[model samples]
Target: MTTISNTERGAAKVMNRTDLTQRLVARLHKDEAVVGGIGHTNWDLWASGQRPQNFYMLGSMGLAAPIALGVAVAQPDRMVFALEGDGSLLMQVGALATIATVEPANLCVIVWDNEAFHITGGQKSLTATGADIVAMARGAGLTNSTWAADEAHFESLVDEALGGTTGPRLIAARIDMTKPAGTTDRDPVKIRLNFMSGIAPPDKEG
Candidate 1:
């Protein structure tokens, strides 16, 4: 495992999810696949710009990383990203260990840790008190996991993950309690078809 710098959660800057989402979208030049978790995470992804390569999880809470893992494993040539909330991630924490075991070099999981379940009446989550996601990720055997120190640091980490040949990188960012920019189109069929077309090879696209 490569040794990347780990930022302490307390020392990390609190940022807005919408801003960070836009920043991440702006950096994707190569048709990378991004699986956005339910609610706010997918809303920001939709607002960022509707890339056909983006998959929005409508009802599922904790399947973003697992879905992205499947995409990463299937499309080894392309980069894959999973945008998940801290609460959702905790719900499927075992995915971290599964990802570590599979070791997909093209996979990168980014957790938006606002420390609350923003969509569900903003209830405080485990992260609000003492849950450390990065530490949990490390314990799950994802050695490349780390807390994003700030927005700039987050971008640099994204760049490194995109360029480097490593397995299952994890980045946790402390986010603010800001609302998402927009709501995603709720057409599950259209979302699935578009994402399928987006990730397909040119010859396979309709």
Candidate 2:
């Protein structure tokens, strides 16, 4: 197997979260489960398209990855994704280690590193000062981690991850500070019901 280091991925491209989210959404054909982290992450996922397989986190800061991890573990055959902001992921960095320990082949984590808390005031984040999330993930044992250098590369990584390359995979996308186009519906109960009902096996009736 050929191994590529994070630096080998090339210089990180500053991208738009909305575009990245749309790219990710367009590639979903297998009813993949997507967990959106709080604020901008879910907002972009919501703006892209609201599917039953998409779960939007309302108030939680750093739970998207953990929640996706659970979903991936429960449904071992389904592709699961977690879209989280850099600040939120920093809040729960330890989750990366936990995900590595589980070693779920179907789990993919995407961190939108905008270098600031875009949802709140645009405060400078650790990443702005040169923190490398992909490196941190690799250190935490998610060796498949890589930084997406550009849009095409991002699509390729997403395709590979969804195609069942040994995961849990983590992709760190350096993004711009533009605001999301829309907001997610603030209904946690409906979100939960819909996501659960969506991921339910086709043969099983709820």
Candidate 3:
């Protein structure tokens, strides 16, 4: 497994979260399922576009990747993406090991590392003190983990992940602490039903 050094990560272009979220959403031509982590992660997803396949995590801190893993496992033909924040991902880093163990070919986890818990009062996260998420992910056996170098590089990684058949890939981006463009509607029931309906196979007439 190749290690991505801190110097390489420091060279990555710091980008705005909302812009990247929109970019990712725009690239989804298929009915790909996106599980957005709590706080601004989900807010940006909601702002990108109200896709029925987008599931927002209203209260959870670190369940986005796990939920996406379940979705990928259940629907092997569908691609799944998990958008998680640095702080939130650290809350359940174990999920990375589990995801690696399962090796869901269609699953991709994108970490927006802004170095702070922006939504929860902007407290500096461990990432600010030198915790390398991509390195940790690789250590957990996700050899495909990498830190996106810039906007174009991020897009290229996403495209590659979407096109590849071997995955359980992890992409970490150094992001700016910009506020989300909008807030997700706080209706868990509706969100759940919408996501289910969105990803469900079409009904066949007898």
Where's the lowest-lDDT run of ten residues in candidate 1? 1-10
lDDT of 3 by residue, 77-184 (tens): 999999999999999999999999999999999999999999879999999999999999999999888898888788878887898587789999999988999999
The TM-scores, one per candidate, come to 0.96, 0.95, 0.94
Judging by lDDT, tell me the better candidate of 1 and 3: 1
Model 1 lDDT, full chain set: 0.94
TM-score of model number 3 = 0.94
Which candidate has the highest lDDT of all? 1
lDDT of 2 by residue, 45-131 (tens): 999989999999998799999999999999999999999999999999999999999999999999999889986799999888978
Give the least accurate 10-residue stretch of model 2, judged by summed lDDT.
1-10
lDDT of 2 at 176: 92
Model 1 C-alpha RMSD to native? 2.5
For model 2, the local distance difference test gives: 0.91
Q: TM-score winner among the candidates?
A: 1
